[model samples]
Target: MSYDTDIFNALRHRLMTNGFEHGQKVRAEHLRLEFGCSASTIREVLFRLSTIGLVEFREQRGFRVPEQSRALIHELTHLRVLLEAEGTAMSIRRGGVAWEARLTAAHHQLSHLEMRLQSARDTAPFVDLWFDAERHFHETLISACGSDALRDTHQQIYCRFRQQLMIEDRAFDFISENIRHHQQILDAAMAGDEALTRQKIHDHLARHLITDAQVEPA
Candidate 1:
């Protein structure tokens, strides 16, 4: 990858993983020195990240990590549910044998990873891997929706939601519940039951559409 792309990915990952605090100032000079790149390159990377809602640019304050809020989280969760549920229903109607095969494979991989995570004594490091599988499984479910725009939109919103969820320090119990929910959704989708799939997707996401007061203290 090009240097600029590498810097952009690294910075984006850091922001997603909460390596930088919310609303923390991201000075271009410091990032340039840290990344061993030019100031303009750092600015470019920051601007790209800002476009994705990971960072924000103010009139004179330069860039900073976007602040997290319960309202924002609820909004993102609602939007994700709407897009994913409709996309899943569309995929169910349009998907063929090939899509079914891919969805089944994705579900198998995700289930295996989740089982391993459940048994592991130290699950922290493996959380990211499990999340990868989870993302793959969900994306595969809607891959046959036949709308590039919808898929792209879902991806962006889902990325932001996942980052915000990680910031919330999602509890192990919640993670276990989420795994079960994924299995339920997968089962419904594989059966080509569009109604059940949409319902499952909405029910799964409702857990996240809560206020800060409703979130379990970690």
Candidate 2:
């Protein structure tokens, strides 16, 4: 890959993982230092981000993380629910011992990552680790769903929802509750309890809609 492409991918991944906080602007000079890129390279990356609806660019205003509407959040949440519930159900039906082993391993690694994030001495490091762990945890849950198309769509929805979610201080109150919800879903899936598993999945997405609305600007 070209240097600019590599930088663009890295920046996009960071935004996806950490949720591009509103007003966290990246200037050309800053990008030059951070990615060892020239001004043109930085502009190219910013343009790519804009093309993807991830940010907005304006003269003098620089690049701004776009704010999503409540309606959009609602729509995304429903889509995620549909995708994940079906995927989880399919996995429950088709997944074998290997899937279970993967699930267990993912959970264990996530637990360690969460602990490190919570007790980290530095805030920036905590944020990075938290986002990484969150992604891995969800990826694990849906990994054995057995349909590449389904998994791709599921991940796309997750990345978009998470970008909006990480824009603010979503860590303090709701994260623990979310972890609990995930645990319940995992337990239901592991036990082959399809109904309870689906319910948990629905509830999880419903909660995302509510939380996104609450945190977003009026």
Candidate 3:
């Protein structure tokens, strides 16, 4: 990857993982020194991240991590439910054997990761891996929907909510239940039960929407 792309991805991951505090100032000079790049390159990378809503840019204030709000979380989560439900139903109808195989593989990976996380004495070490697997499993579910626009929109919403999830540190508590939900959704999809699959998706996502603690003053 190019230097700018690498820097962009690293910065994005840090932002999503809460390595930088919410609303933390991200100075171009600071980033330039950290990444060993020119000021222009850092600005370009920050601008790219801003476009994705991971960072915010003010005319005179430069860039900072975007702050989260309960209202914004609810809006994003609601939109995700609508998009994912419709996309999943379309995937169920349009998916071929290859898609099924991919979905099954993704689920298997996620299930195994969840099992490991559950048994481990400390789940903190496995959080990132579990989240990666979880994302893969969900993406696999709708991979065959044949709508780039739908998939892209779903991805953006998913990323935003995932960042919120990481910030709140509540995902660990839901691991077991999350695994069960994914299993149920997979079962419904494999059986070609569109209604059940959509319902499962909605239930699973709705469970993670804004919690009281997330909105409390920071």
- Output the number of the TM-score-best candidate: 3
C-alpha TM-score for every candidate: 0.90, 0.74, 0.91
Q: What RMSD, rounded to one decimal, does every model reach?
A: 3.1, 4.3, 3.2
lDDT of each: 0.84, 0.74, 0.84
**Candidate 2 displacement at residue 19 in angstroms:** 7.8
Candidate 2 residues 16-119, lDDT tens each?
A: 66635654776768878877768888889888877755667888878877675666677778888888888878888888888878877777776666566556
Superposed by TM-score, candidate 3 places the C-alpha of residue 119 at a distance from the truth, in angstroms, of: 1.5
lDDT of 3 by residue, 1-218 (tens): 79988998798777767688776898999889988889999999889888878788999889987777667778788888898889989998899899899999999999998889878888888878877888888888878999999998888788777676667666668888988899999999999999999999988877657666676857
Of models 2 and 3, which has the larger TM-score? 3
> In candidate 1, residue 89 scores what lDDT?
91
The weakest ten consecutive residues by lDDT in model 2 span: 167-176
Model 3 residue runs over 4 Å out of place are: 210-218
Clashing residue pairs in candidate 2 (N, C-alpha, C atoms within 3 angstroms): none
Q: lDDT of model 3 at residue 100?
A: 91
